[model samples]
Target: MKSNRVSTRGILVTLCADESRVGMPGRAAPQGKLTGIGVKPIGEVQWQLLYRWLYGVVELLSGEHFMLEMSHLDSLCFEAFLQTFAQTYPHQLHLIQVDTCLST
Candidate 1:
C-alpha cells in the first residue's frame, strides 16, 4: 500500500468553542479577524508567547477563524510546524480539516 500524503502550504484557520470569551483580546471585534493588537516574534521565547496569545484569542472567539500563516515555510517543515502549533494550543483551537487550493 502506498502512503498517501497531502501537501499544503499557508495558514490554517480554526474556530474556537463558544462560551469561553473573557479578558481575551478581540473578543468584541468582528469574526474571523485579529484584534488591533499586533504579534511580534522577538525571539524563540517571544514567538512561543505570541503563539499562545493567538491561540487564546482564537479559543475564546468561536465562529471566528484562526489562521496559521505558513507561506514562509517549506513543505518539508510543514508537518513539524503544525505539530508544534497544535501542541502549543491544544484544546484551545479546533482544527478545521479542509484542503485549500492556491494559485501562484
Candidate 2:
C-alpha cells in the first residue's frame, strides 16, 4: 500500500498502507476531524484484539451511515463475517466505495 490523498464531495481522504506488509486500511473522515485511521499493531497478539474491537464498532454502528474500505482484505472468512454483521444490524448502513482499487 501507499499514501495518497484524495478529495471527493468536500471530503478529504487519506489512504495509508504498506504493500510489503499485510495490515488493515485506515480512513480519515471528512473535514479531517475523525481519526479514521484503523488500528495500529503493537505486537502479534494485538491483531486479534484489534479485530474484536473492529467487530464491536461494526456492531455498534450497524444500520448507521458509515464507510468501509475492504481493499486491504482478501479473506473469504472476513467477507462472510461482514455479511453476517451487515445482516445483524438494524439501521441502514450505506457503503461508499471511494476508490477503484477495492473493486476486486
What's the number of clashes in each of the models? 3, 3
**Tens-digit per-residue lDDT, 1-104, candidate 1:** 00111112113334332112123233332333343458653433211112111112232323233344333333434455457556654544335442342322
Colliding residue pairs in candidate 1: 11-68, 12-68, 13-66
Worst 10 residues of 1 by lDDT: 1-10
lDDT (tens digit, per residue) of candidate 2 on 17-37? 211223554443232333346
Which residue window of length 10 is worst by lDDT in model 2?
1-10
After superposition, candidate 2 runs with Cα above 4 Å error: 1-72, 75-78, 102-104
Q: CA lDDT, every prediction?
A: 0.33, 0.32
